[model samples]
Target: MAPSRAYVPSILLLRSLLRPLPRQCSLSHRLPSAPSRPKSKTAKSRIRKPDPQPVDFIQRGISDKPGDDVLNESGVSAVEWWEEDASGNERFVSAITNRDELRKHEEQHKRLEAWSRGEEDPNEPEFRNMVIDELKKNPSFSDMQDALEAMKKPLIERIQEGEEVDKEIEAEDEMSKEEGIREAQEFLQNLLEEPSLEHRRDQILEIQAKLTEWNSVDHPEFLEAMARLNEATGGESVEEFQNRLNPYLDIEHTALGSEEEISPQDKAEMEKLAKGIADIHDLLKEGGMDPELEAEFAEMRREIGTDDWATDVFAEDGEIDLDKLERAIAKFDQAELAEAKQEAKDEDDEEDLSPEERANPELKAKIDRIMEDPRLMERLAVIKQILTGTKAFVSNVKSAPDPTTLPLAHMTTLEDQLKIAENDPEHLIALRRLRVNLLPPYNDHPFLRPFNEALRFAYVGANDDVRRVLWRSYLKAKTIPGLIENIPDDAWDILWYSQAVDWASNQNRFNHLKILQKDLASIGRDGPPTQSVGGVDVNEA
Candidate 1:
């Protein structure tokens, strides 16, 4: 029993091998062998001689012979000339050499076919050994054979089905919960469009009861619909109803400790809602709905539902909606507007009186109040200063020339004309600041400063008729009107005057400027004041 020892090379042996590498052979140097053989069986494939060329390329000095010109003008030597051209000949010779392997494969195929058809004994030892060897070479064939046996059962019969489809249906049921919630919300939204609040409330209650059966109380939209339903119940806040429903709403709280008891405020709010709901039912039974009040209430509810009620309150359409306007007005102290109305009403009720009879202590008090207004006085002072200063500046200063006709130096000097403007920094800043609100065609020219200031004063006094002295002073001045008419159309200083007139007209300043008011009446603007500013043609004014 000779024990075979696989030994590693010793350092001396390795060294000897390394030394021999230069002399040759470490472990049989990379072995490559060349074969010389006889091809006598392929005599037809012998190299053929080329036909003689019409012109002797070699004699033409294109040959590689000594003294032959490599730079032949014909360029024939550029090609690889040789004694024999054997390109592509080897491919044919190779095909011919492979015939025996092709014959062996064909014979093997025929033998395999004969065995499969039982023409020969497939059970013979040689054939059995071959089949077994092939199976062993490809183990996947065995797996395929097993699969074929299994496929004997039809696919339809092989499929086992039961719990899988049921589980899928259950998953769909879970996924359809959102769809159900959406349907419920849509139903409630339809109820909101109902004309009768009581009917809407009844439908909402029914829908709410059905929704609870679906156990959709946990959804946000469901909670929101519930709040709306409580509102539709009429006369009740949702909080009040929720307080009454606290025992049920806080049922989840029962699971918590006593520390999580519902707050008293919540209970109070719920109580209020419950009482409101009952009151609404009784009121609906009474059947005398005030259209205006109900409309206003509905509008308030809509506003409360909006995301930006503050901005909506000031919106144009919102301001015009009677319901929203009434509700908004109801929220504020309307004493001022009421006082104005009462005064107007009282004046109308009074018997026709002379101008002396129209005068009273109250009239004097109004004048005193206007005079006492520090804001009014301050505005007047500002207007006076603006007028005086603007007059002085426009009179003394010269206008810039047409820069287009001037050279670069002259244009630069024209720009330097700012020295005159720069001397009045305060005026420039003030005028520029006021320019933002200047009427059209009236830019921030120094000449327009007086008019702008006067208009600003007039606007401030528009709400207080007694404080309109400054407005009248500017409007009634011959110099101002003359300046306005003679001004260029491009200058538009008249726009400010027109604006002041418009402000006065808007404020119904007839009591102060009876002449302008009469003019307005002639023009069909004698009715109550409107929010819109009537267009006043400056030329006509």
Candidate 2:
């Protein structure tokens, strides 16, 4: 598709915002330092009455871009035809006074409090003189203590009122703040809704950080207003709120990591991983499995969702649960027999109906509605978007999100990887610094940018909550064979990894990774050039 007209604008805005950001995540990043903004010529041009034109350049920047205009950080003459309203000066003066009036009240009040407490610094003659001069004009404002105490009543009343109807008062102020946020968000939305711009993605991350702060305080209310605004405009940037607000709500996230972010113990854990991979390779080559089992098992790693069935066999003590499987097989066999019997008894005319016909799409739809009677459509729409393709910022690592969501299998794999790495403490150190983690081997790594893109694509159709491995598990189930003899009881992780990779490489219609990741995917399937991951025998089956 030739890019939409709005696409470029949104991309520009996103690019501005995304400056200096790094990928995947960290508690710290290459942040934009406070730019030594040139001395605003207008700063000294004190608003003789909010000059309609840029009395100074700073004012020029503000007035030049109507709060709604999508202007760059450069001097504001982005469009030649833009004009100012006739009442701009009057309104500017009024707004300025309104702000100053409140500031004056607050300053006077604070000064009185400090003087009454006798805590005013002796060296600060300017403040002392100002207080004396103000008292001379209003002699009744004598004895600083009395004035301070007099102001206290109203201050306390105001505070109580603010506290009592805080949400209501906040609701009003938030409207104005949201207006500002919306303008900014609109600009940012335009910037990001573009063709893939990896570098710009980083900049958007920072802009998102700023938005995150705003969303944290007035989340419910702000989101509602934002929703309405978005509805009217069909803005694409609304998607970013999830990224912004989600992080703010999660206290552990900071922009990225600082020098002191990781602990020694975490470093130690990472060291074991390198060695772990090698060990698994060795074990797989020498396990007690029959050749038939080994070959069938290696080839049978179906993609995505099938691992759940695999995990059911592999229990936590790290052994297969054959009895459980035996029961499942019996129950399934019985159900199959009953289904077959019912089908045989069906009217002759309907005996050949396919599964889709049997579902009776219309009836199924009606039942689905009656059963939930909720926003099933909305949820499904979101689910479809996520499953079909990642909306933003997912990586192209080996594994993908599975729907079954049992973490035991995934966790066990990571634990095993870490265990193997135990031999090399420094590598463990680097791995430990990776705090907000996912299953290793297939994980989001900044250095591995290609993987990140693939991961994002995988995330498109998955939920951030309830474990994001849906597609991996969902699709894998489709490939299960007539006989469940290929998957071993103890090799659940292997099954998961193998299946996830194959699905991504073979079945996924759209490979989101660029040249490198697509190549990585190919190389990965072949297994990383026979390099050893510190041989610690990860093979359980």
Candidate 3:
């Protein structure tokens, strides 16, 4: 066995030695209530389990260490230690005997010292330092989560029983807790009060030679590396990047208390940097957790008007092949392509001699005669009916209608305008000739009202005309009393109507809008409410 560092002076016991030496002590010193506690014989047998490593700590003025044997025959485990400095002063590596009590006393001392120095407020976010770190960091996250979860059951039990406790004692506990939290907060405030390089922007631009003495790198290289990885991933494929960086994530926190690897001063800095790096990696992973939704390209094509020139652009993936596009647009806009395709399909249907085919080339002759008519409206009506219902023009329901039939009515208004442009060649020439930019393309499709509205809103940002339009829509919608209740409550906050109302009110702009004005009648009925807007707080509400 290794020698005990101090020998305890043969007559001294740890608990007893804590008192002043008798006779050499001052007259004012009184005997503490020791309660005649016996040396617990079975206390040695109350051994739990051994740590993978031994306990290690520093105390006020103790340097107790033992060799690898780890413990005495007694239950109290031996401590290990290291020398403090060049002065040959030694420090305790562990305190296993009075572990919990000693640690709590130490924490209390530190807190008292901090309070004496006015370093923190009495009430801040802090818990009992039961084991140095029973509280620290956001407990809602990371490995501490399971432990916090376990505490929920006990806390609920306490809360349930607390209902029966004397109110005064409960209030005292609350007061103590509040004081502790305030102290912690004030301590943080004090630490951050000294402005740094980033805090003093102007001073940072004017660097001084003396400032190098105080230069600090808040983030370590690991944090820098994680940040670089995050940036390189384009903030999209972050999960893959985080998976790649996960190996380095918990390095600094190898063990719950291994943060002591560095000196106290550097320990704080080290853990801060490591935590920041790990947190950033977590955030990167979170940002990309939502999988990409594949675009419904087939549905997109279906939405485009088949006979509209502007729509066929949907079939192409990239920049329009201008010459090819113009040709296709001309055919589509004039319904020529649709008509030719229909004719080809009709001829093919005659192979089996279906009922539609039995009508034969005689209908073809009639179709040609009808197409030659000078009245465009009458010809359009015939084409529309033939496409919508081949049965209407054909006498038999048994007929397999020609799939090649043109759908002139299904064509867009823009297609008709293009045809008119093709005839006149000069009217609205500016609109006809204007090209799409591809990026944020202008909505020029005459029949696509919603798309036009979206483009108009995007281009104009927020305007009074849009507000008025939205207000009228809201009025119409709310006029049906049940309609408002039908809308999901979740949508109420972000609803466009709410935004438009806010914009119209300009709640923060003109004082007259939010405050009372002298010109009540002249302000007009639509100005604002005579009192606060709808009796709401008008600021917070």
Residues 1-541, model 2: lDDT tens digits: 8776653567778888979854643322344366344468775464233333334655655666434232334534233222245554321111112334446657877877887799864323345445544554442444475655554444344434435444643454456446545655766566567555444655655555667575542355555554554564454455444334321122121221111112345335323322332222223333232354344334433522242234333332222333433333344345446545765776574768777667456533543443364543443343344344542323544576674686764545433544444323343333322222222222233433332222333322222221223323322221221101111122222223322342422222122112112322322332222333552221210
Model 3 lDDT per residue over 242-274, tens place: 223212122222111100022355345434433
TM-score of each model, paired residue for residue: 0.14, 0.18, 0.14
All candidates: CA RMSD (Å):
40.3, 34.3, 34.8
List residue ranges in candidate 3 displaced over 4 A.
1-97, 115-541
Let me know the TM-score candidate 2 reaches against the reference structure.
0.18
TM for candidate 1 is 0.14
- 479, model 3: CA deviation in Å? 43
Candidate 3: Cα lDDT at 381:
44
In the range 1-541, model 1's lDDT, one tens digit per residue, is: 9999999999998888878435563323333376335468575355343444523654555454433323233433223212322453322111112335445546767889997787976533345444544444343455575554343233222121213433643454444445445555565555566666655666576766667565643444555666766665654554443323312132121111111122366446434433332333223223333466456455655754653323233222111133343433333224335545766876875687676666466544654554465555443344345346555755876888788988875544322443333224342333233322222233343445654454434332333332343334334331221122222222232223333454412332222233433333432454223323664433332
Off by over 4 Å in 1: 1-144, 147-186, 193-218, 221-541
Clashing pairs in 1: 239-269, 239-270, 240-269, 240-270, 240-273, 241-273, 243-270
Of models 1 and 2, which has the larger TM-score?
2
lDDT of 3 at 40: 91
Off by over 4 Å in 2: 1-218, 231-237, 240-417, 420-424, 433-541
Q: What lDDT is obtained when candidate 2 is compared to the true structure?
A: 0.38
